[model samples]
Structure formats: structure tokens, C-alpha cells
Target: MVAVRLSADSNGVLETPRDGDRMSAISRRALLTTTAGAAAGLAVAGCGAAGGGKQGAPRAQRTGEHSGASGARAPAKTVRLIGDGSTADTGPQPNQPVVDRLEPGQTPPQFVVFSWDGAGEVGNGLFPRFRKLADDHGATMTFNLSGLYLLPEDKKLMYAPPNGPLGASDIGYLSDEHIRMTLDNLRQAWTAGHEIATHFNGHFCAGSGSVSRWTPADWKSEIDQAVAFVTQWKTNTGWYDEEPLPFDYAKNLIGSRTPCLLGQDNLLPTAAAIGWRYDTSNPGGDQIWPSKRMGVWDYPLQLIPFPGHSFEVLSMDYNMLANQSHAATSSDPRNYPGWRSQATASYIAGFQRAYETNRAPFFIGNHFEEWNGGIYMDAVEETLKHIAAQGYKDVRMVSFQQLTDWLDAQDPALLDKLRTLEVGEQPPGGWKEFLGQVPASTATGGAGEGAAPAVTATT
Candidate 1:
């Protein structure tokens, strides 16, 4: 079992008593009462450190290889469909990095997972724009696709979101042309070796019957609808000229981020039963190595050092916009430059926070919208360019699935030992003495991970 180290409040102030094991810069809501209390509270499964999964449900399968620094995918020999020809098994994925085990005496890779919500191609061309950006940086991101993006606006009434009126959504249905564009981008993204995860159907973030109050059963229905919409988009939209998405979404899909990052407690059981490998729906987490929740990987948006703020903020564009511009508007162009700098710096700071310390995987969430005259988009792009640059070659910008594979292949106890390193605290006695004794063979059992060149952290 991993020992508990330190617990800090939102402002990075340590308040919880420490036994020198695991530490967290978690928000008040995710903070623990004590050492054991925190471990007990955080670990919801009964499977000890390895964590547990659903009853009788099989574990999620690892499909892609960790292609190392090159991020190459195995070419598919032939294309074939599983059921209705909605998706095909196109040969090798073009840009995936094989998930490999860390070697002995190696420092952990400073992993940064860049993901998008409602990952669809709009008329603004952000989808293709970012896809190229990711490819250029050797980054493979998780695209949490909206189900209704495949269903045309004319077919809006087909959706049945829980508790809401039939065919309703906080984020409305997509137009037929937009759906086609979304499909085009999705196909291209899959070919480029990025992950296509779900964002659920009919994103009802709040009000009665929203995700905040959804149950396991409710989530199942939503998930089913989301899948059905994608696999049956041909029937839904009657567009036969386009080539089908080049992967069985049911098999390809192994994880998701919920609408607004709410209702994860109820979502996990459903996800586990369906053999999903991980969930990025967590609302508040730190830049520490992630632990499994309900036997599935819990990769959450971390709370990072927000410059000029008393408390840290979620490492997501939405939260940053909420803090910088309360109404999510950009009417005053005067604040654009400063706001852009702050947003960009926030992401860089979040990466540095983990990179310099625990080397926990940094997860940055974004959207396709050009919020604040697209300053947030610019901010994220700038951060990506720097982090994936030659100077920071050790930074591995991977998808959640690639990361989970690496994590699962690891010896759990070793992960617990890594957990003992507090945020920004190096190995107690350096790498040699700290990881002196290697454990028995597991999946590619190795002694260490790696890190990148340090980026300046802005407050």
C-alpha cells in the first residue's frame, strides 16, 4: 500500500498531516481528512493497489502499440466491418506511439495528455487545424466526440436524453453539413492515430435530469444512444457517398469524458461493465500519477497554479475562461492580449508543476470553439509548440489509452513508491539509491521513467 505524504488546500498550502507516502494538491472537495482516510476515500475499489473492476466484466483490451518517440502505428492489412458497415478496420494507425515500459534507472516521461471536448469539425476549421498541430508535435490526443454530431439537425427528435424532453440538449444537434464535416475530421483523425472517445449524447450539464444527477443506468442509456448514433449515422443521415469511419467505434472506444466533467461516480460502473480502460471525467485532481477508480484509470483535469490568483484552477479552457471572463464573452478586446498570455502561461505552469516535481502525467482539456477571439486556442497552440519542441524532446504527448497501457504494465507497488514523491520533490536519495532494487517481472517491468527540459513556471 502507498503511504500518505501531504495534503494541501486549493492554494497549494499543505494542511493535512503526512506519513510521508502520497501527497495531493487537490481541491477541498477531493482533499482527505487524514492519511489512511485519504487513501480509503480515494480508493473506492476492493482490489488493493491494483484496484478492482466490475463484477464478471472483462478488462479493457489494449489495441495499439506504444510506438515510442516516433509515434508510428501498425498498418492495417485489410479493411473490414464488424456489424453494419459504419466503421472499418483500416490497416495500421498512422501516428500512434507504441506504449512501452520504462527502463531501469530511467526517470519517468513527463507525459502530457491533450484532449478535446465535443470533438467535432465545425465550419471554423478548428478540427483540422488542431489535428495538424498535434501531428506536428508527435502528440496523439483524445477526442471526446459528441454523438449528435453524427445525427443531422433534422433528426434531433431521435435523441432521448434522460429526464429531458425527447430530442433535447444543452448543446444542440449538428446540421447535416456540419455532421458531414465532423465525420470527415473523425475519419482523418483516426487515420492519423488519435483516439476517438465519447462526450455522450445531448450534453445536459445542469438543470433537472442533467449529468450531475445521472445514475449508472441513466448513463448506460446515454452511452447506448451515443454509440447507436455513431454506428448508425448512415441510417440517421442517409449519406452513403462518404467512406465509413475506419474503426469499429465500440471496439475503438475505451474511454470518455462526461459533459462538463460531472457525474463520474455513476458513470464508472457503466464504463467498467462495457470494458472501458479509463475515464477523464474527474472534476478536480492534481498533477500526480493517477490511480484507478473502480478498476478503471481515472485521468482527471488537474488543478494548476493560476497566476495572480489565491486558488488554483482546473487545467481546462472552460474553467480558465470562467475565471478570466465571467460571462465567457470577449466584447472588450483590450484584455485579449493579457488574457491570452495568462491562459498560455497557465498551461505551461501546469506542465512545469508536474514536470519539475512528481512527473505526474499532465492532462489539459480543451474545446474547438475560439473563445475570447480565439485567444484560448492560440494559448494552447503556443503551449503545445513549446512543450513538444526539440528542447523538451522527453515530453510525450500521448492519448489516455496509450498512457493507461503504460500504467497498467507497471508494477503497482512501484507506482505507489513514485506516489511517495511529493509534488516537485525529487527522489529522496537520487535515482540510483531510490530505485536500487528492481521488482520481479510483470509487463515489461522496468525501474524508471523519464522527464523533459524544465519550462519556466509562471505564478
Candidate 2:
């Protein structure tokens, strides 16, 4: 048994355990109402809170404790909420949609390429090739830049920090000079109309089990810092030539791919509060705007699991390619031929599957290190040529931010319809489904059985 206490300081909701009890903190805003029943030997706590706002002051703070028949109390788990109010039995009502109308045909879904787990070397190595490929195909792409790249020192810090909440084994090799070069490359991409967006400053896991560990405040801080950092960079660069860069596209500069492809089901409210419209973290089907979370659309990548494999190969190839050892393999130009041909073949098959089906948006993700070898670069170039050969009518390659802006500007009714269109259990048929299931582990790895998938080596 657990005793839970709820209190709201000016900062937010805080929860602490009483004598002998256990509790868990929830992310939504709702007043927790405790219903105690002695006869049933059960105490059900209900949370009833309305939308965010100040309520009447509490008459008295309520506290409860539970013990066994022998009068022996169990250890308690502490949970907290950040608001002022009494605990209630009701949960929060879903946000009402402003427009609830439907259109006839589904909007043609867009293909977006997303990479995960930052590797500055990989980013630096691959961007040129990727840029050329995009140019050849006349398509734009979105790179969910890992927060690891933004670390004050090492570039890998952009993916997961060295000592913070999400850090594990740090493998950053990019120095300040390298980072500046990488940033310059990003600026070039931005100038060329590519999308640069956040992949979580700390690569925070977003699935159900792991997500419960994040407090609302924690979410706010992580996202806020990421947005602030990117905004600051753009602002600084805009003034580089003694002229203000146009701010017309600043707001559209929002897109994210959670580390390890963990879904953001639990972080919707926090994301909404921060004004993000699309997250490419999870892959499943054709593009979908989920009904439960308003305004956000999910575009999943599609690919099939490689032969004799439990998982797909894209992320694995990404990780392997990013590791320096793989770069050494590419030093020999002769060996590049086979690997390049294989990689290009794989990517072409994936892209063609999506394109032939009219899924205009296809996310082809890879880590920066994947392009270290000249062979890998050649493969990437070949893949681009293959995509171009498909003859996409208006292959408007776009960044995640651009997609969000377009969605935001649509009629509210259209937006609602997009959100309500269910893609069934998984994302639409294509590479989106193939790429959506990247593995993520919990903090303790396997510490908690019901816990969400934490960071782990999936491939």
C-alpha cells in the first residue's frame, strides 16, 4: 500500500509519500480525489481536474495512509502534481475540437527522412551527399538534429548528454571546429530549404513505461531548452551579414523524432503546450493525424525487416556506419563497390515502394557516420538518382517545420478531419511501418517489467 500527498507550490504540482504508501506521478492536469473504503480493503484515488486555471483555495490538505491487518504499513511511493486544488474522482476531459468536419479524399501523405542518435562525424560526412541527392531528386528533407549536436563542447551531447538524465555511453568525437563546420553545413541546408528540427535535447524516451518517469516540468524544460538553442543559432546566423534573417519561417522550424523511435503517446499535452505540430519519431502507416491528440500529425517511415532478422536494418546500418570502425572499412575504395551497391539497392527498393503507392512523403533515415566511406557516399548518390527516376510530379522535398506550417494554415475543419482519420493499428502500408519500430529501453534497462522501452541497441 502507498500513501500519496498532492500539493501545488507556485512552481507546479508536487507529490510526496506519507508514512507507508506508494504512488506515481501523472503528466496531465487533474485534481486527485481519494475514495477510501474500509470494507472492501481498497482505496481508489480518482483525479478530477478541468483545463488549466486557478481554483478556490483548499480548505484543508488531505492525507491518507494504509496498513495491513496486523498494523504493519508498507513502504510508500511518492508522486507529485504541479497545481493547486483538491483531489477529485474525475479525469480531465479531452480537448474539444474547434472544427469537426470531414473532407472526401485523404490528403496525399508526404515522405520525410528522419535520422536518430546523433553522430556529428556522420552528419558532417553525409550532409553533402544527402544534399546532392535531394537536389538531384528536386526534393527537400528534414533531419531531426539530435540535441547531442548542441552540447556546449562535444557534438554527441546533442543526442544524449554526458552527465544528465539521458546520458549513457558517450561517443562524441566532434570538436568545436568540427561542430562549427557541421553548423555551417546545417546553415547551408537551411538556406537550400531543408528542415532542421529537434530530436529531444536529451533523447528522452517517450513510450508508455519510460514516459511516466518524466514530470511535466521536466518535459517543459527539455523542450524549452531545445527550442531556445535552435532559435538562438538561427538568430545569430541571421545577423551574420549585418542583416536580419527573415523570421517568416521561424515558427515552422518545429519537428522532432524521439530517440530510439519511441512513440510520443504520453508527451502529447506537453508537445501541444509547446506548439509542435508533427513528430516523426514513430513509424507505422500512411501519414495520420491522431484523434486523441489534436493538431499533431504522425508520419511514419516504411521498410521491411531484413532477411533472418527480428528488427529492421536502417537504424542498425545507421549505427554501424556511424561507428568509426565502419569508416575504416570504407578507406579501401575497392570494398566500397559492393557495400555501395547493396545500400543503394536497399534504399531504392524502399523509396520505390512508397512512391509507386503515391505516398509522396517517404522518410529515409540514416546517421551521419553512414556516409563516411566514399562507397557509402556513392550509394547515397545512386539512391537519389533512383528516386529521381520515379518521376514524382511535384516532388516538393520539405522539412518537418514546413509540413507543420502547411498543416497549421489549413481550415480548422480540415485539420480536425485529418486528426480524426484513423490509420488503424499501424501506420499506412509502406516504409513508414518498416521504420517505425526502432527499439528503446528504460533507464534501468530491464529494471521494471511494465516500464517503457528504454534506450537500447535494437539492431
Quick one: best lDDT, which candidate? 1
Global lDDT of each model?
0.65, 0.38
Which RMSD does model 1 reach against the true structure? 12.4
List the candidate 1 regions with Cα displacement exceeding 4 Å: 1-77, 441-459
lDDT of 1 by residue, 1-459 (tens): 111113545454222122232322211111100112232112110000000011121111111111121112334256676456677766555555555555455677888888877776556667777777776656778788888778877888898899888888656655666676677677666766678889887665435765768899999999999999989888777765456777889777889888656678999999888888789877667677787777777887777877776667667765566566642334488899998898888899888878877788998887766656888789889998878664776688888866776776666556766777765677766766665554644433222332111222211
lDDT for each residue of candidate 2 in 345-393, tens digit (9 for 90 to 100): 6566555554444443455554443233545446555666665575665
lDDT score, residue 78, model 2? 28
Please give the clash total of every predicted structure, in order. Answer: 21, 51
TM for candidate 2 is 0.52
Among all windows of 10 consecutive residues in model 1, the one with the lowest summed lDDT is 44-53
**lDDT comparing candidate 1 with the true structure:** 0.65
State how far residue 378 of model 1 sits from its true place (Å).
0.5
